[model samples]
Target: MMTMPTISNQNGAFPLLRKTELRRLLTEKQLQQLEQFCRASSKRAGSTLFRQGDPADTFHLLADGMVELRARPPGRRVYRTVELIGPSCTFGDEALFGETTYLTSSRVLETARVLALTRPAFDRLAANHPDIALGVLRCAGNCLIKTIRRSAILTQAPADVGLRMLLEELAGGNGNGAPIPVRITHAQLAGVLHVSRETVSRMLGQLASEGTVEVGRGIIRISSH
Candidate 1:
């Protein structure tokens, strides 16, 4: 069964106008058309926004909260989470390019405010604002490609190196080479690394003993040394 969100009216210029890229991509009249057309919806936690193999009639931009995308093989019972979408992100985007069905299922992990646009609405916009729709598609596709590439680079590497590199990335380079502590768990690390929990634990413990990383409750701090 799928969970559905209730429609809500929005006032003022549509939220998409607030995005700089969209603002630059759209004309004044097109922007007004969007404001008049777009609306908002609130999805409760545990809501199944869409299911695998469902028709892809709409794509959504998340305003806040988390949505998890999970995939199960055509005849398999096992489902694995493929992505976690945060606020200000887009999902169901293949529909924008004419993909007929969803490859994965989308479930709300927390209460989420979403701005959903159907294929018909997008078509209406594209009639007069083709560039506007393409611009959003380009941004979304680039972001998705970059994320996939980064994840591949991280997870496909050897375990110890992968963990170190991922932590450094989270630390966001303070310029002086000091890295802030990042809160994460062994299970999460294992999942991303495609390694066993014991492997992650042993590797982390070894690094901690070498004075290279400080491991605390659900957090790992990289030593300045």
Candidate 2:
């Protein structure tokens, strides 16, 4: 089997997960105890830890690495990139809506380590640790609000506008340089832009012709010009 290339971080093996409000939100008695049983598990690049429509009773805390939340749109061979999650992130809270299935699959973009906790386990813990559960609920609520906002933006914005928004977001992320070195495939860009691969290529060609961007084999650079 072919092996994938490894990308190393400047600081350490993985990005540091700082103590943010998100982390603090999960620090209740239930989460504190769940933390004790926490086993950090890792996966290889291009690996999928969970698939869409799978059971969603557990919450996964991504301790390290990047994950892509994807969905296979009807009649499409491609899995669209719905969201990109980084370290110190939690996923699968959609299950709390009493839904038995997941809305999207979680795939590993790189080697990843995650802490998994089931809803039953969290519930038992939360029964005695109400404050932590409340905090967790609040965190989930915030995520839902953000999702709503993103949906509104996508629905109202033009394709180029949406793509530019994503570019700015990636460029502003920590550790990314001014040139915004984003190396991704055209197909990947299609997924991100919620367009067909052909559309992505055509739009990208237009951008390049306009001197607004440059595209190589699988990488694209949004230029300042």
Candidate 3:
């Protein structure tokens, strides 16, 4: 059975979305109209928002917390996390553009609030407001570019270098001395790096031994020294 989202009252009071890429693309009027289509909901951690291959019927905007996009290739026991969606970002645009099914499964990584618009609603909005449609297209294009770049990195870089680059990104290039704020598992890191969990564990251990990083339960702190 398909799960229904738990609805909440937002009353179009989401100011954060106005600071995102969507705001850059949409005019004030368009933004207001777009919000009119939204219905807010709250999801608990570990809840699956939608599964891969499910019928694409809605688009979502993360109002708070995190969501992970994972894709399971056929005959594979594990799913790779393709992207992490954070607050103020939108997802599920593939559905708006006529995709029949979701390309990846979305699962909540933390307690989250989301604003959703059904495909039909999005289509109507797009039909009436060409600027909103254009903005969404640009956003989707940017996401595609990032995905392509990540694929290139995974294929071209050595596992350790790729892992380091990923850590640096998570750490926000804090001079290699600051802790990466996000906590992740070896399995998830393995998926992102296109490597095995054992490989990730071994590399992390080596880094820890070298004083390059400090590993704790669910955390890895990079050493700036």
TM-score of each: 0.68, 0.72, 0.82
Stronger candidate by TM-score (1 vs 2): 2
In candidate 2, the residue pairs with backbone N, CA or C atoms under 3 Å apart (3 or more residues apart, or in different chains) clash, namely none
Candidate achieving higher lDDT, 1 or 2: 1
TM-score of 1: 0.68
TM-score quality measure for candidate 3: 0.82
Against the reference, the lDDT scores of all candidates come to 0.70, 0.63, 0.75
Off by over 4 Å in 1: 4-13, 16-32, 160-193, 196-225
Q: Cα miss at 100, model 2 (Å)?
A: 1.5
Cα lDDT for residue 207, model 1? Answer: 87
- Candidates, ranked, lDDT: 3, 1, 2
Shift in Å, residue 27, candidate 1: 6.4
Q: Candidate 2 clash total?
A: 0
Model 2: residue 91 alpha-carbon error in angstroms: 2.2
Candidates 2 and 3 compared: the better one by lDDT is: 3
Scored by lDDT, model 1 comes in at 0.70
Q: Please name the candidate that would achieve the greatest lDDT relative to the true structure.
A: 3
Which of candidates 2 and 3 is the stronger one according to TM-score? 3
Question: What's the candidate order when arranged by decreasing TM-score?
Answer: 3, 2, 1
